[model samples]
Target: MPPGHVADRLAALVAERESQIVLGLDPDPARLWPDAGGDPDPAVAVLAHCRAVIDAVAPAVVAVKPQVACFERLGAPGWAALAATVEHARAQGLFVLADGKRGDIDVTATAYAHGFFDAGGLNADALTVNPYMGLDTLRSFAAVARPAGGGLFALVRTSNPGAADLMDEPLARGGTVWERVAELVAELGDEHRGPESGLADVGAVLGATQPEHLARARELLPHAIFLLPGVGAQGGRVEDLAPAFAPGRAAGLVTASRSIVRAHEQSGGAPAAAARAEAERLRETAWALG
Candidate 1:
């Protein structure tokens, strides 16, 4: 535990920022500026790209979702880039969400918690967790995050195309697997809810691609902040995400990466200019709905 509840912390930031757009930081070395770099180590270029993206979109975003796998793929250097990125994003007054989707039992889970919490050095405001291992796994994470004012967004329903194979499968008990996962997240949110924000430290990662699920997921976990990914390039319209804002203006978060960062592809302008413009566009669109 660090100090306050992450749910409330996020709510305050959202209100102040007046933007629910979460900038997704997925840096692909091969696609970086110049399309080719002489920086012997790709991670170096990756770091530069990440920083530029942050600088470009900070004004229109409330947080940045750094795909952990991108940095982790570079081994030690990649990990260092991740830490640097988190630090830089924080310095810019932007919230950081570590999108590692880690899950395990006992020490492994505990260790993962440390990485997401301030002590482990990741210093992320919130982490995305995989709850398939069961509630016990989530409990371990929540225990470490709660007192720190950090938060967790357990994977209740993901945005991947194949997610329905498991998440939408029918269970003997009733409803789909995702529905059950929603129930667990809702319970966790209720239990760890912050009185001030009327929100839970636990959150959910439901796909923006599947707008139908938003209403149901919100119904299940009213206080849990919904991190709806797969917007922008994935064809998820911002206008269809109204239900996610039912809990309050801060309840739903719409995330975009390539669409904003790669806007130059469509606009034929400088990377920074295109990114900032796209981010601004998204901000106004989502803010209006809120």
Candidate 2:
């Protein structure tokens, strides 16, 4: 990796924070905290809710993954809110991973990259991408992101049960579809491996709910960082993800959204306090595995 590669930066942050937990910010207008304040505009309220959550959990997490659709659904105001939320997370010293899952080829793919990695755009540290479109599409996104010290996390085996419909299908070439994608992830990330961290700027989004697939993913993409989602509300346990940390703690980032943000609902306390506690708990659990 170069001096300021995204993988290096990410590993540095993980070490500094002593945590690999990524706070997932998928705020919903209807689900805003009771004390998220009395903003009349839904977009503004959503931003407040996100900021509050970030403030509460920032100390325990190294990054935040904001689901783009949550903000995009509200139109222009929502877009602005998303930008503001990203800024706020950065202000709190957290890496921002824009969860857009964008995919395309040629100019369209480049456009998505700019929208997330450029100075005038979200300028996120990383973005989730869909690799179904093939390597050329990934190369296009990386062409833009890598130079900017940003990274891409390609979707691999996801947490959804329906993922089995495609990802688990046996290929005529003698491997599952997701396994092939993992090989591509490894191939594309090969040249961008970070020297200090030994992690690639290109990473994989491996759902934590599917712990069984982790060892295989590691075998194929040894140098890639793994973004493990589906924890908390998605029924994934941090204890089951031991294999993902084999490459190092920063190699596996465990993302939890509802479990952290909506923690008060189950624990019975102020939203911020509950969120902070839950995030800390996750941080400790994941850090121990490392």
Candidate 3:
């Protein structure tokens, strides 16, 4: 799975699915579904919730991004549920991204890559990566992701307000730390290009909640894909995502998590029904904006 091979698979999947959003599955035990047993095993409850959300939203989105911490906390049982959920998503023709944000040097990074991108994996189609470790640390992950036709969304400017403490700090080399991260995204994407749109395989995670950074990030990584998180409950407006689509409709992926999955709480309707409606609403709004 070289860069070209994986890029092709991703592009084709997105095209066929007619979606760019990757719904994140981050189940919190304290917020278990209403029907969940009082003494319900946290892992079992999470697995059920994930499946319900996937079943509800799969038709509207192309992929699902599961946060590893949510599952890791449940230990082996949690991992098993994660693998099962991933299999279900694929069975429904949806791509999966393990949102672990894993990063380290050499072999450590390489092993992490194998865990997420390998064929025998829980069958993830991509994973979020932390580029703070330097471009070299990403080599092993890239090696697996590129060839398998999987992908990585390197963190650049996260949505959390506290990110300014570091990500927005000025660097001695010039510009801010995030600017350097943007440069790295552009550099890694220098090779792979989309067959039709000319976009690249490498991408950056630029939170949609921080619209101000979108324009600059797009400029820096002109050819790289952009994964825009923080929409819906996070206060990111779909209308503010213009810069992300500058490269074209397929350029940026608008991801939402709790907002879509927990819509039932707001609507006072059946969880599955509410979740489906919410995902469709976001999909419609985002598609129009893009």
Query: Model 2, 1-290: lDDT tens per residue?
Result: 12398998999999999999999988889899877846999999999999888988899999999999999999999999999999999899888899999999868999999999998999999999999999999999999998888999999999888999999999999999999999998999998888899999899999999999999899999999999999989899999999898999999999999999999999998999999999999999999999
Tens-place lDDT per residue, model 3, 13-95, is 76776777788888898886666524468888888878878887899898888899989989999999899888888888876
Model 2 scores worst on lDDT over the 10 consecutive residues at 1-10
Each model's C-alpha lDDT? 0.87, 0.93, 0.82
Per-residue lDDT over 1-290 for candidate 1, one digit per residue giving the tens place of the 0 to 100 score: 23577777788888999999999988887788553233779888888888888988898999999999988888999999899988889888888899999999967987888877866578788999999999889988988877677889999888888998899999998899999998988887789787888988889999989999998888888888999999988889899999999988788989999999889999997888898999999889999997
Error of 1 at 132 (Å): 0.6
Instruction: List runs of model 2 lying over 4 Å from the truth.
Output: 1-3
Better of 1 and 2 by lDDT: 2
Put the candidates in lDDT order, highest first: 2, 1, 3
Global fold similarity of model 3 (TM-score): 0.94
Ranking by TM-score: 2, 1, 3
Per-prediction CA RMSD (Å): 1.6, 1.5, 2.1
Q: Quote the positional error of residue 107 for candidate 3 in Å.
A: 1.5
Which of candidates 1 and 3 is the stronger one according to TM-score? Answer: 1
TM of each candidate vs. truth: 0.96, 0.98, 0.94
